[model samples]
Target chain A: MPGRGLNLTDLSYFPGCSLESSARESNISMMEAAEILGLNLIELEDWNCCGSSSANILDKEIAFSLAVRNLSLAPPDRPLMAMCPRCLYHLREAHQRLKEEPETLRAQERRWGRPISLGLSIIHFLEVLVRLGPARLQQGLVRNLNGLKFVPYYGCTLFRPPSLRQGSYYQGEMGNVLTMLGGVPLDKALTQRCCGSFLSAARADVVTPLVNEILASAVAAGAECLVTSCAMCQLNLEIRCTWEPRLPIFHFSEILALALGAQDYEGWFTRHLVDPRPLLQARELIP
Target chain B: MNPPAPALNLRGAASPIVLAEQDRYLARDIERLSRANLSRCFHCRSCGNGCPFIRGMDYPPNGIIRLVQYGLRRQALESHTIWICVGCHTCSVQCPMGIDIAAIMATLRRLALAEGAMIAETNILDFHREVLQSIKQYGRAHKLGIMLRYKARVRQWFADLDVGLRMLAKRKMDLKASRVKAIGEITRLFIPHWKR
Candidate 1:
C-alpha cells in the first residue's frame, strides 16, 4: 500500500540468512528483477540474523533483541522490504512487540545506540509488486513464459501466522503476477504446504515424506515446476525430494527475472540441486 | 455430535492418570506464554489431521493441548510432539477455534528445556544450538560452520554427506561466514548479566 499512491522507487531490502548464503540465486535474481522494474533495493547495512526460528526456539529474549537490532539499523526514510518471509515475519513480529512494550523498545534502543522508527513499514516483495500495479510489470515484460505450468509455493510464515494477519495477505499474488507474465498458475496442489522448515536439517526422515507429498501433489496437478517466494522452501523442496523426475523448484525471483529477460539465469539455474534448465528449454522459455 | 475418539497411545497412557497428580499450573503457564486459550479446543482432531509431522510425533497437536489442559506436566513436556513440531502453523490455521496450536507447541518446547525434561529429539535441539552458535559468532548463520559443528556434536559424519557435498559443489555453502561489523555488540548480548 505504501507504493500505491506514491511511486516508491527505492526501498531497504533484508535478504535473511538463507538468501545471503544457500539461496544466493534468489537474492541475485530478486535484485535483477527489481532493477529491471526500476525499483532500487538497498541492502540493510550490517544486518544480522532476524532471530531465526533457531534463536526463537532456544531463547526468546535473544531472539527479540536480535530482531530489534535489525529494526534499529533500518533507515527511517523508507519502508523496509524483505524477500524472505520468515525474516519479514520476525522483523515485523519484533516491531509489533516493541510497539506494545515501549519500555522494552527503549531498552533495545539504548542497547543498540540507535533509535528505531516505529512508523517504518515492513513489506514483502510480492506486496510491493502488487502495489506497483500490473502496468509497471507489463512495461518490462521481455520474455513470455510460454504458459509454463507451475505451482505457486508460498510455504508457511507468509499468511499463516496470526500476528501477521493484519498485514497484506499474499496468498495468490504469485499466481496473479505470474499469470500476467504468460505463465499458467496451477492451483490444485499443496501450494501452502510446509517445506519441512528446520526439520530438513535434523530430521530429513520426517521432511522427506512431507516434501514428497507436496511434490507429488504438484505433479498430480500437472505442474512442471514449483515457484516459491521463500528461499528456504525453494532449497528444501529441491534438496529434500527423493522422488524421481523431480520437479525443478524455482525461486519466485528467478522466474520473474527470467521473464524480465535477465541474462544471468545460467548462474542461478546452475546452483539449483535439480537442474531447471531442461525444463526451461523444453518450455522454450530459455535457449 | 460425533463420539469422542479413543485416545492415541501417548506417554503414560498405559495407566490411568490420577487427577490429583496433575500440576494444576502447567496449562495456565502455557496459555499465558502462547496466548492461545486451550479451553477453546474441542478435540475435533483438525490439528492432528492437518499436521504435516503428525506421523513423526508421539502425540498430535490437539493431544498435546489435552495433556497441558490435564496438567500432565511431565508427559506434556517429555512428549516427542513438542520437539517434532517446526511451528509451521499448519495446525494453528486449521483449528476451527482460532487457536495458535503452533505457538502452544513452541511454548511446550521452551518449558521442556527449562524444566530439563528428557528431549525426545536431541538431534533437533543440537541442530538448533549449532545454528544459534553460528549466529552468535558471525552475527549471521554460516551454513557450513553450523553443519560442521552439528555433525561433530551428533557424531554422524556420514549422515547426509552427499547433500553437503552437493551444496558445496553448487557453492551454496559459503566457506566464510558473512559477519556483522560491530560484533562486540552482538557478543555482549550472548553474555549473561552475572557474567558481565
Candidate 2:
C-alpha cells in the first residue's frame, strides 16, 4: 500500500480534452511531478475522448464509445489514469454502466469493433499521486512556494455522473500535498463548484458568472494563487479572471514539482493566463 | 453480500429551524441525487476544499449536502446559492462521498427553476441553458449560433465580443464545424435515455 511502489513502466493516461489545449499546465506539471515522485507515465497506445463533453450531449454513444475505446487500449496489467473530470466522468461512468449492464457492453463491443475487457481499472492522476504519499513528494519540489496562498479549484468532476464513490477513487489530498509543500492551502468553497466546464465555449454566457463566482472565492480567500487537479476547471477559472489577481493557477503536480526542487519554473510555470509572477515574486521562490 | 440500504437520518426536524418544516432528510427525489452515492461522503471537503468558488457562495457544495441531509428542503430549493453553481461537479470525483454533487446540483437546478428559485438574474443563466440546449439540439455548439442567441436574449447582445475574439485568437472557440464529425451518427447508437 505504501507508495503503491507503482512502477512507471507502462499504463494508459487520459489527459482529457482541455489538457491538450487550455490546460497544458496539468500535462507539463504532471510530467514534472511524475519525475519527482519517480512515476513513469506511458501515454496510452491509442486514445480518444473520455466521452463527457458538450459534444456528447447530443450523442451519448460518442462519449461512451470513445471512453470504452481508450479503456480497451490499455494493456491488461496497467491501470488507466485520467486528469480531466469529464474524461474521468465518461470513462468512469461508462465503467459503471458496463458493470451494471453487460448487454450494453456487448453491443458497444460489436459496434466499435473492439473488445473491452471488464477487468481494467480507470484512475485519476491526483488519486495516484495521493496513493504515492508525501515522502515520494518530498523528492519532487524544486522550490517551495512559501508565501503564495494556494487554493485548490476542484469544480464539477468532484460530483457528477461519474461519482467519485463509483470506481477507483482519489482522495481530496490534492490540497494536502500543496500544504505539505510549504504553501498555504486555504480551506475555501467553489473548489468543487462548477467552473462552467462544457459551458466555457458552448455556453460562454453562463460561463462568465459561474466562473466569476469561483474566482471570487479564490480572491476573497486572500489566495495569492490557485491550484487544481482538473484541466477544464483550470481553463475556466484562469481565462475568466476579472480583477486580474495575477495569481497563476497550477496543476497539482506542477506545484509538487516546484516544491521538490525543479529549477525550471519559467518553462514550467510561464504558460498561464493570469501571470503567476506576482505570486512567485512575493515569495522569492524564483529569482 | 447485502448492499447498504440507502441510509436516511431525518431527526433534525424536531428542532426549531423553519427550513426543516418539510422532510428535508429525504430529497424530493433521493434516487437521482444519490446517484453519486453521497452516502460515501466522509466530509473530507475535498470538493469544497478544491472548489475555486468556495469564497463567493453562501454555502459551499458540501454544506449543501449537509443541508440536504438535514431535510432543509425550502432552503436548498430556495437557494440562490445553487443558482451560482457552474455545473463543474469536481466534488463528485474528489469526494470520498463519491456523491454526485454535480448531478444533485443538476436535479437541484431543475427543482430550483421549476419552483422559481432561479429567477434572480436571468441574463447569464437563461442564456447559459439556452446555449446548452442549442448544442443538445444540434449535436454541437456552433459558436456563431451560441453567440448570436446569447447576445440577442441578454440585450447587451454584443458586449462579449472581446471575449470571443480572445478565445478565437487562442483557438479556444471555433468558427467552422457545427458538431464534431461523426457525433450525430454515434449519438443515435446508444440506449434511449427515457425522460420521466
Candidate 3:
C-alpha cells in the first residue's frame, strides 16, 4: 500500500512443473489471490520446463535451451511472472546468459524455430507482491490473522549468487505480505537456509538433517506456521521432516488467498503431509 | 606371529611433488569449461563451510577447487561432491572470491558424464538421466513416468513406497505426461545439442 493508486492489471504467469503437479495448491491459491487483487494472471502459452536443479547439473546447454524455450513463449510486452523460485532463477539466469552470449541465443533460436528476444523480463511472484505493497494488500484483507506468528522461509533459489536477487536477500517481501494479512512475521536466522532441494530425490538422508534444522529453528523462534515461495522447498520441508509437533508449511500465496477470503482454501490443505488446518482453526481463521 | 614389514628408505630421492603435464592441461581445461578463474580461489574454506551437502562429499568444495588447480581431473570429476551438490547455489553465494562454485560443480558433472569418469553416486546420475528423458518425451516433466523410470533404473521401486502412495492418495501424482504442441521443437533442441 506504499503507493495508493499503484495496481498491476495483468501479468504473464509461468507455473513450473511442480506447480502443475505436486504444488497444485500453490497454483490454486495464486490464481485466487490474483483474483482478489484485481490482477489478471496470463499464463505463458506452451511454456515448457525450466530445466531447473536437474538440467543445469546434467548439461548446461540443455538447461539454457530448455529455459529459452519457455522464454520464447512469453508475451513480448509483459514481464513473465513465475511462482516457483527454481524456475524463476533458471529463467533469469538463462536470460542473463543469453544476453551475454548472443551466439548461444542464436543457436537456441534455431532449435526453438523462432527469433528469441531477451527483452522480456522474468519476475517472481514474491517480487510482484512486494511491489504491490503491504498497504494495498491490507486494504483487501477480509480476515485479520493477528495472532498467527509466521516465519517466512526463503529456501535457496530466490536470493543467491547476488545476481538473481530482485530485492533484499532475505524474503522481506513475504514478511510484508504476512504483516499486511495481520499475521506476525517472526525474524529467524535460518530463513535463507537450504532445504536440500533435489537431494531429497537421490539422498534423503542428507536432506533430513537440513530440513530438521530449518524446522527446529522456526519452532524455536516461536512460529505458528512457516510460509515460503518455493514449491520444492515446501515439498522437501513438509515431506522430509516427521518430527512430533510439526509446524505447518503454507505457501505465501495460500495465506494471501485465505486473507483475501477464499473459501475453498481448505481443499488445498488436504494435500499437505503435515495438516495445517488444525493450526488455522486454532487461530479461528477457519470455521 | 606376524612378519615385520621392511622400512622404506629415508635417503634423499625425487620428491612426489612433480606435476604431470596432463594435470596442468586438465586444470586449464576445467578453467575454460567452467569459465571460473581457478586462480581466484585463495583456498578459502568458505564454500566448503557453507555447503550443506559437504559432510557427505568425498572432497569438499574448496578441496574440489584445489584439485582443479592441481589438475587432478579424475579425482575431481569422480568425487561424489559434484553429484551431491543439489544445485542450491549456497557455495556460489558464500564464496568471497565471487566465483560461482555451483557453476563449476555443474561443469564438472557434465565433464564426468561426457568423459566416462567414475561416478561415485550412480543413483544421482540415474535420477538426472530419468528426469531429462522424461522432459525429452514430454514438453514438461511427467512425475509418474519419471519416478517409474527412475525406480526401474535404480531398482529401488520400494524406496519411498509409502510417500509415493501418500502422494497418489492426495492426487498430487499426474497419471499422464503433458506434451506441448511444439514438441518437435524441443526434440530438435535436444537431439542435436545433447547427442554430442
Name the lDDT value of residue B15 in candidate 3: 22
Global lDDT scores for all candidate models: 0.91, 0.62, 0.81
* Model 3 whole-model lDDT (C-alpha atoms): 0.81
Residue range A128-210, candidate 3, lDDT tens digits: 77777777787889988856998899888787754576434445778877786789988764888889887788788888888
Task: Please tell me which model should have the higher DockQ, number 1 or number 3.
Answer: 1
Worst 10 residues of 2 chain B by lDDT: B6-15
Interface RMSD score of each model: 0.6, 6.2, 1.4
Better of 1 and 3 by TM-score: 1
**Reference-based lDDT, residue B141, model 1:** 95
Per-model fnat list: 0.85, 0.21, 0.74
Q: Which stretches of candidate 2 lie over 4 Å from their true place?
A: A1-9, A159-162, A167-171, A202-206, A244-246, A267-270, B1-159, B168-196
* Predicted structure with the largest TM-score when compared to the true one: 1
Tell me the lDDT of model 3 at B148.
Answer: 88
Number of the top-ranking candidate, with lDDT as the measure:
1
Candidates sorted by TM-score, best first: 1, 3, 2
In angstroms, give how far residue B52 of model 3 lies from its true place.
1.0
- Candidate 1 ranges beyond 4 A from true positions: A1-7, B1-12
